[model samples]
Target chain A: MVAPVFDSGSFRDPDGHVFFYENEIYRTLTTDAVHRMERLLKLSFVKKSIIEGRIIDTKILEATKIFPKDFLVTEYVLWHEKIPYVTYPFEWTFSMLKDAAYLMLDLLSGLLENNFILKDGTAWNICFYNGKPCFYDILSIDTYVEGQPWEGFSQFLQEFLYPLMIQSYQGIDFQPLWRSTLAGIPAKLCYKSLSRSSLFKKGVFKYVYLQEKLSSNKTISEATLKHEFTHNAFSKKALTNLIKNLRLCLETLTVKSDQSVWKNYDSKNSYEEQDVKEKEKFVVEGLKALNPLSVMDLGCNTGRYSLIAADIAPVISCDLDPTCVDQIYLKKNSKILPVVLNLMTPTSSMGWHLNERKDIFTRVKSDSFMALALMHHLCISHNVPLSHFILLLRSIASKGIVEWVDKSDPMVQFLLRNRKDIFKEYTWENFQHLIREHFHIEKTLPLNNGVRQIMLLSEKKN
Target chain B: MNVLMYCLPLMATSTPCCAYLDAGSSSMLLQLLFGGVAGGLVFLKIYFRRLVSFFKAKK
Candidate 1:
C-alpha cells in the first residue's frame, strides 16, 4: 500500500505509465494496451466521445485494488480525471492552439469513423479540460492498421499542423516557438519560416510544400516503402477523403492581430464608465472576500478583471499581450486560463533536468491575486522596483487585489512619456511604504476616477 | 532533374523498407496521394450538387 509515484511527464508512453496513488490519477495498462483498451471500451464512439466533451473520462481501476506490489505485471488500471491546471502546449493561447488543433482533428475524424487511429499526434496529447480541447490519451487509440499511413501523420504535422501553420503564416508568436521546441514547429522549421507569399497559400502547396518535399526525399523506395505498407489499401473513401482534406486544411487557418500594445486596452483606457463600474465593483468585492480556489489574473488586459475573477475562482489569466492573450483565448472560458505571461519576463526553469519544464512561477501559483492595470507596467514600464514589486506580488498571492497607478496617472503619465522619471520611489507614499512591507492592507478602494487605487492585500502573518 | 534521375534508378533497385517507415511514412504516403485526389474531387462536387437537386425536385 505505498508505491505508485511515476508521472515525471508519464515516462514517454510505452503504452501506459501515469501514476500517483493516494491522490488518484492512475493508468497502468501495457499488456500491449490491453487489446486497445478493450477495443476502445466497446466503442459506441467511446460513449459518444465521453458524452461529447471529446473524451477523457476513463474509469476501470482494480489493478489488484490499486497497485498491489506495483501493478503486479499490470494489464489495465486507468482512472484519470485530474486536469485542473496542467497547461502546456507552451501555455496555449492562439485560440488555445487553435482549439488544440481542432481537438486533434476532431479526435482524428472521430477515430476515423470508428475503426480507430491516433497512435500519437502529441501536442502533449491535448489537455485544457473545462475550457474545452480534451483528448487525454486513452492509450492513443489504435486499431486502424490497413495500409498504415496515418500513423499520426508525422505527429500531426509536427504537433498540430506545423504549430498552426507557423502561427497562421508567420505572424510568429507560437509562444516563443512552443517554448523552445518540445518537438513541434519543425516541418523543416516550418519550411524555413515561410513567406514567398506564404508559399502560395491554400493548403500551402499540399500541407507545407508537399510535406517539405516528402520530408527531404532520400531517394524514397524501400520497395516503394514496402509497397506502401503491404500493398496499400486505404479506402474508407480514402480515409474519409483524408479526413475531409484535413478538415479543409484546418479550416483555412487564420491569425491577423498584429499591432498590439494590449490590443486597444479596453477601448483606450482612462477608465470612467464610472471608472469601469468602479473597477468592476472592486473586483467583485475582492473576489467575494477571497473565496479563492485559485485566481491569478495579473495584467489580464482583455480579460477584464479576469472575467470578474472568473465568477469567483479558476482564473490564471496573466498577459503581456500576445494580443491580450489572443483576446482572452477567444473567450472559450472554461473559467479563464489565458496565459502569454511576461511579468517582466517569466517562464524560465526549462528542459532536461533543469527541472524538466516547470517555471512560470512554478506553473502558475495562486491562492488569489489580481494586480489589475499591473503597477504601472511593473513600476514604470519594467524597471521593477517598488520593493521589488512588492516582493513579486508577495510571491504571487496569499490573497491580493493590488492596482495602485499614480505617478499622476494618465496611465502613469503614459508610462512616463519618453522615460526619465527615474521613479523617485514612485510615490503614493512610496507605494504605501513598499506595500506595507509585504501586504496586510485589507481594503482601500478609490475608483470613481480619483486617479486610481484598489488595494485589498493580506499575507502578513510571519 | 528528371525527377532526380527517375528516383535514382528506383533507389538502386528497391527492397530496403521497414525501419518503422520513416519520414513520417513518406509524408503520409504523400498525404494519402494528395488527400485522396482532393477528396475525390470534393466527393464528386458533393454528390454532383445533390444530383442536381434531385432533378430540380422532379420538375
Candidate 2:
C-alpha cells in the first residue's frame, strides 16, 4: 500500500488539505467545514455540476474505508476525482482564463441561489479538465448570509477581473502578470497599464477607478470597514446585482491579438494536404502502438495533431501563442487540455517554498507526447539545440512523435532568411545519432515530398 | 425584480467566519454603492468629488 502524500499546494486552505493515496485523491475536511460539504452533497446544482463535469466529482469516505486511518482520523474524509494534469493560471491563455472567471461567477451565482456562496475568488480554485474550466475547491462554499455583500468581491476583482481587464483594454497578456504576482493584480497596477481615457470604459469607473480611490483611503481600516459593513443594511438583491454587472463587464472584455507567426502555423505551413494526412496517420498509429494513458503535444499549433491524438487518449496540447491555445480551447474537444506554454521558458516552481504551484515539467509529465512541426521553431528559431529539445521530450514523456523539417524546407529557409546558418548539426544523421542517445527510434514517416520526416520513438532503457 | 418594487429594509447580520479574506473596507463600501441606479448615483457623487479633488490637486 502506497503512503498518503500531502499535497503541499493545497496547504493554503485552513478547512483541510488534499492528499493522494494509492493513486486516489482524497480531502480531509475539518468539522467546521463539514456542514457546507453536507449541504453541497444535497444541492441540485452541485449534483448537476458534477454530472456536467464542471465540478470535480466527490464522495464522502466512510470511516471504515478510510486509508491511512491514523492520519486525519478525526476529520471527515472525502474522495475526489483526480485531474490528469494540473495547471496554474499563468499557463492559461486569455480565453481559458476568461472561461475560468465565468465558471466561478456562474457557480457562485448558482450557489447563492441555493443559499450558499463561494468564499474564495481565486483562479487557483479552478482547473481545466479537457479544455473546460472546472471548480474543485468544495471547501470554498459557505452559507450565504441574508444581507451580507459578497466577501469575495475584492478578491474576484484582483485575481480575475483586473488581470482580464488589462488584457482586454491594453492587449497585454495576463500570463506574465499572473506569473509575477500570484496573488492577483492590484487595481492600481491594472490602472497604470490602461490609458487615462480608458477610465470611461464600461466597468472602468465602477470596478477599477472607484475601487482604487476607495481602497487608497488609509483613513479607514479593513476591520472598521467590516464593522461598518455589518452595521449597514446590505441586501441579497444588491449582491446579485453586483455579480450580474460584473458578468456583463467581464463577458465583453477580450484580448485583441497580434499577427503571431506560430499562431496559424498549421494552416499556413508549406506542407501539402496529402503530406498532412500521412503525418496524421503516423501520429495516430504511433499513439495506438504506445497506448499511453496521456499525450502531451508540445508546440501544439491549433491542436490539429492533438485532436488526432485525443482520439487515442487525453492530450495536454501546448503552444506559445495564446491565440493558438485559445483556438484549441474554443474547439472544446473532449480529452484535450490546451495550455499556453513557451518551450524556451516553461513555467517554473513558484509560490511559497516554490511547491505551492507545481512547475510545468512536474505537472506535464505524460506517458507519450507529440512535437509535430515544432523542431524547426525550437532549434532554428529559438536557438535551442536539437539535442536539448529531444532531451526535454525524453524527460517529460517516455515516447513521442517528433517531426524534423529539413534545412532545405521552405519554412527552414524562412527561419534562416535573416540569420546566418551556423548550425552544422541540424542534419538527419545528427538527429538520428542524438535522438538515439535518449530515445530508441521505432519508425519514420516522410512527408511533403520528403522535405519533412516524422519519427516515432520510445525512451531507450536506462 | 425592478427597483420600483418596494425596497425592503434588511437588517445587516454579521458572519465573521464568512470573511476570512480581507475584503477591504473601501472595496466593500464601493460594491454597496454599485448595487443599482440609486447606488450608482451615490458612487457618481463620490466619483465627481474625487475627480474635482484630482484636478484641484494637480493644479
Candidate 3:
C-alpha cells in the first residue's frame, strides 16, 4: 500500500489536501475538485506543453478507492526521479532565480492556453531538476473561467519578477528581502525601493507597476472570502500575455555580483602543485575502490574534490558560503548538485509542517561521503565531540573517507588564529578510537604536507 | 507514468525503517508518483479481494 509521505499544514486546500503516495504522487480531490480536473484535462495544448517540457505536466491517473469519504481520488503523474539536491530560494544565486522566473512564466502561458490557470505564483514551487527548471506543485493549475482577474498576479510580481528586477535595476541584494519578509518582498516596498529610472523601463513599467496597481485596488467581497473554495473570473488572454511578458523579462534579467571567491581557489590552497595532485590521486583511487553511486562532500569548497568523486558517483557538494556554492554552480554542470549548507548548522527540516521540507539526514543518504579538511571545523568551531561527529557522519553516508588535520596544520592554525584552544582531546589517537568504534578503518595515508592524514572507513553492512 | 511510480520502492537499494514515515530526500514529485501508484495497487488489491469473497459466498 502507498503510505503517507508529506502533508504540509499550510497546504490543506479545501478542494483537496495533497499527499505523496508510493513512488508516484497522488492528490485526493474533493467532489468539487473533480470537475476542475476534468475541465483542465480537456485542453490539448496543456498536454502538449507539459510533454514538450514547456509547461509542468500534471498527469491524471485511474481512480482509487483509498480516497476520503467526501473526495474523489486519482493518482497524478509525477517526474521519473527526484533531483540529487534541493536548494532553497534563500540559497539561490542571482542567475538561478532568473532561470526560475522564466520557467514559471512558461508554465503559466501553457496553462492559459489549456483554459486553466495557476492558483498561485509563489517562487517556492519551482525546483531545478536535471539542469533545467520544473514545477514542484502539479496542482497549482486550476480550471479557468472568463472575466476573473488573475488571483496570483501580484504574487508573481513580488515573489519572482520584482526581486529579480530590483536586483537588475538596483545594485542591492534580494537576499535581505527574503530573510526579512515572509510572503515575498511586498509590491509597495519594491516600488518604493526601486530607483526612478526603473519605473520608466518598458517591461518594469507595464508589468510590475500596472499589475501592482490593479492588485492593490481589487478587494474580495465578504461573502466570497467566507467561501474560499469558490472560483473567480479567469481571462485566458491576459493570463497568457502576463506569462509571456514575465518570461521574456526573466530571460533578460541579469546580475553581476562583485566577486566570487571559489573562482580563484585552485591558486589559493596552501598545498604545492605536486601535493595537490597527490591528494587528488588518493581521493580518486579511494572512490574507485568504493565504486559509490552517490556521494556527499561535507565541506566541499567550490567542489575541487567533489568533482573528482562526481566522476564515479552523483555528488551533492555542500558548503556554507553562498559565493562558493554559486561559483560551483556556474562552473560545474547541473548533474553535480551544489547546495549552500553549513556543516555545523546544515539545512534542517523546517516549515509549518516540518514534513514539507526534508532535513539534511532525511534528504541525503550517500553510498560514500568525503569530509576532507572538515574535522577541525566540527571539533574546533562547532565544539562537536569527535565521537558525536563520527556518529553524525555515519548517518549521512554508508562509508566515509575523511581527513584528520592536526592542530599544527596551517589551515587549523588559521581557524584558531583568533580563538582560544579549548580542543584538548582533539588528537589523532582520540579521533582514531572514536571512528573505529562505528567503522572499520581500512587504510590511512599520511599526506605529503605532513599536517593532514586521510582515513577510509567502511560501515559493517548487515 | 502511474505504473512507473510503483517500481521505485522495488528499485531502491535499502528500505529503511523510516522509509514509510519519510523516504529520505526522494522528491515530492517522485514520492507523489511512486506513492500514488503503490497506493492505487493496494486499494485495488483489497477492493478486488472483497469482491471475490462476496461472489464466492453467494456461490
> Candidate 3: misplaced stretches above 4 Å?
A1-6, A31-58, A65-87, A162-182, A188-241, A248-252, A331-334, A353-355, A460-462, B1-59
TM-score of chain B of each: 0.23, 0.38, 0.40
Candidate achieving higher DockQ, 2 or 3: 2
Can you write out model 1's per-residue Cα lDDT over A1-462, one digit (the tens) per residue?
356677666666687887777776878887767777877877887778778777888876658755566444365678878776666786676677777877787777777778788877777788777777788878878888665666667677777777777878887777777678876776667888888888777676666665665555443312144344434454555666666777788788878876476788788888778778877887888788867888888878888778878877888887867778778777778888777787776787767766656677775678878887788887788778888888887887767788888877787887788878898878888888878877788888777455678888877877
- Candidate 2 per-residue lDDT, tens place, A188-271, comes to 788888899888898887788656655654332223434433545566777888788889998888877663566667778898
Candidate 1's displacement at residue A373, Å, is 16
Q: Residue A118 of candidate 2: its Cα lDDT? A: 82
> What DockQ class does candidate 3 belong to?
incorrect
> Over the full model, what C-alpha lDDT does candidate 2 score relative to the true structure?
0.79
Lowest-scoring 10 consecutive residues by lDDT in candidate 1 chain A? A218-227
Per-residue accuracy of model 3 over B1-59 as CA lDDT, tens digit each: 55453433333233223223221112111212222343334333433565687799999
User: What would the C-alpha RMSD of candidate 2 be, to one decimal place?
Assistant: 6.4
True contacts kept of each: 0.27, 0.41, 0.00
lDDT of 1: 0.72
Q: For every model shown, what is its TM-score relative to the native structure?
A: 0.38, 0.88, 0.72
lDDT of 3: 0.63
Q: Assess each model's interface with DockQ, reporting 2 decimals per model.
A: 0.14, 0.20, 0.01
Worst ten in a row by lDDT for model 2 chain A: A219-228
What docking grade does candidate 1 earn?
A: incorrect
Look at candidate 2 and give me any clashing residue pairs: none
